[model samples]
Target: LRKSELKGLEIPGKLERLIATFFADDTTVYLSENDDFNDLQKILDDWCLASGAKFNIGKTEIIPIGSPEYRDLLRQTRFLNSVDGPKIPEHIRIAQEGDAIRSLGALIGNNICQVEPWTKVLERIDQSLDQWARSKPTMEGRRLIISMIVGGMTQYLTKVQGMPKEVEEKLTRRIKRFLWDEKTHVRINKETV
Candidate 1:
């Protein structure tokens, strides 16, 4: 949608003046600054009809951001706190502040800076490492797996979010330990591997 038209719409807050990001078929409309859910839905419907592209309401979600006070305000004024909103389509979901929404293989939410999504990835890595340890792979095999599979899995996420230093350290420790057959408190000589 055009910024000029959205500005004219009767929506609360500064989002009306904000421009939407359009990439190919995906259009990201930021409604976090406004609490006008009904008006926004109407605009989306009208846009979909005019563009001849169906708006997949089922895939659409309202992800609220900001502090507790802002969240409360959004809940009270925008009807996003509750799961039920008569004005909102039945298929559209409302994601709470702390809820994680998977987008492009990364977890996104209001507090994505915390790297909560990495926890899931860490768990999966742990499981895989455990299985690999039981199989007793050779050092060369382990190195290949770590450099290829594990590294590949996290490459996009690291590039996107840059991951927190602590999370990267933890993953490094885990990988090193796994490489050493789960040996703890032992130094690994990099040149040997």
Candidate 2:
């Protein structure tokens, strides 16, 4: 009927310090509008035990869960890079030949000039997308689509410019894989009611 903190436990003290880094043990009081005493008490007990912190049963109360008033707060919160799309620099937002070549090299786990042409191809794709976007707003989707289109064009340009055959072959294989992934997707259309 009364809350109690487990005392005389040194091991638990050390554990509490360690877990506190990852979990919170803050006091949050709630009062239930409905008679869900059984469920609420069980929840309090479970959380108290699991968290290695004593729940002040005397002070604990369950309230009806309601939505936060500031519903749009989440939209303005700053988030980590992982939460944001593609971990690339802002300057390279559009794929440039230099960026593409770097990405191609990155893909094949290579550096140096092995995939320079591929990088140039990526740069062209980026430039082309920018041009298309400026000319037609609806063509925004063409950004990714043009990458595949220009991959072939840039590869041809690279050949005319006389890139190494081995490098060419490697870039071709890498771009093919990239295009295959982008072009090949499952389309699920909804049946009308």
Candidate 3:
């Protein structure tokens, strides 16, 4: 759905502070520090009814992003109803501190700064590279794979999440070894003319 269809879904007074991103069929709404979840939910329910679109509560989540104390505060608060007076069903899940939520191919935790998600991405890349290495492609072919496949995988994540320098270095070393078929322990030397 489009943003125009979901207009007026933001909390009344906090409209200026809300941050919402719509990509394809996914819509992410970020409320301000002072916004109330109940109010936003009500608006969403109303929008769904008005637009004749079903609100899939099963796929929806309320993730608290902050310190432990702040998250605890969220945990204590109970969400009973939407602004329109409809009760929220008990089957809808609220994300806990250690819960891993996938959003747009990136893993998210309660704390926004956690790097565990990036580790998962790295592990996937390593597995893919290992599988490709089994084919015994030429060094030039390996370099092309590194540039196109590996590089493309991290390009978006690095720009969005800011990968650590050490991780980049380690991945680079692994790619180098894979390029040489992991036979020689010595490093590959390039002599300039």
Residue 94 alpha-carbon offset, candidate 1, angstroms: 4.2
All candidates: TM-score = 0.66, 0.21, 0.70
Q: What is the Cα-based lDDT of residue 112 in candidate 1? A: 46
Regions of candidate 1 where Cα sits further than 4 Å from its true position: 7-18, 22-26, 32-39, 65-68, 79-94, 111-115, 184-193
- Over 74-163, each residue of candidate 1 has an lDDT whose tens digit, in order, gives 556555434345444555676676777766555677754466768877888888878777888998989987887579768888876668
| Model 1 TM-score (2 dp) | 0.66
The lDDT values for all models are: 0.68, 0.39, 0.67
Q: Of the candidates shown, which would achieve the greatest lDDT relative to the real structure?
A: 1
Evaluate residue 189 in candidate 2 and report its C-alpha lDDT on the 0 to 100 scale.
44
Ranking by lDDT: 1, 3, 2
Candidate 3 local accuracy as lDDT? 0.67
In the range 44-154, model 2's lDDT, one tens digit per residue, is 688778888786554322111223321122122211111443222222222112222222123211122544555656556555555554654333344355555655556
**Lowest-scoring 10 consecutive residues by lDDT in candidate 1?**
3-12
- Candidate 3 on 121-173: residue-level lDDT in tens? 78888898888898888878898988877888888887766787777787877
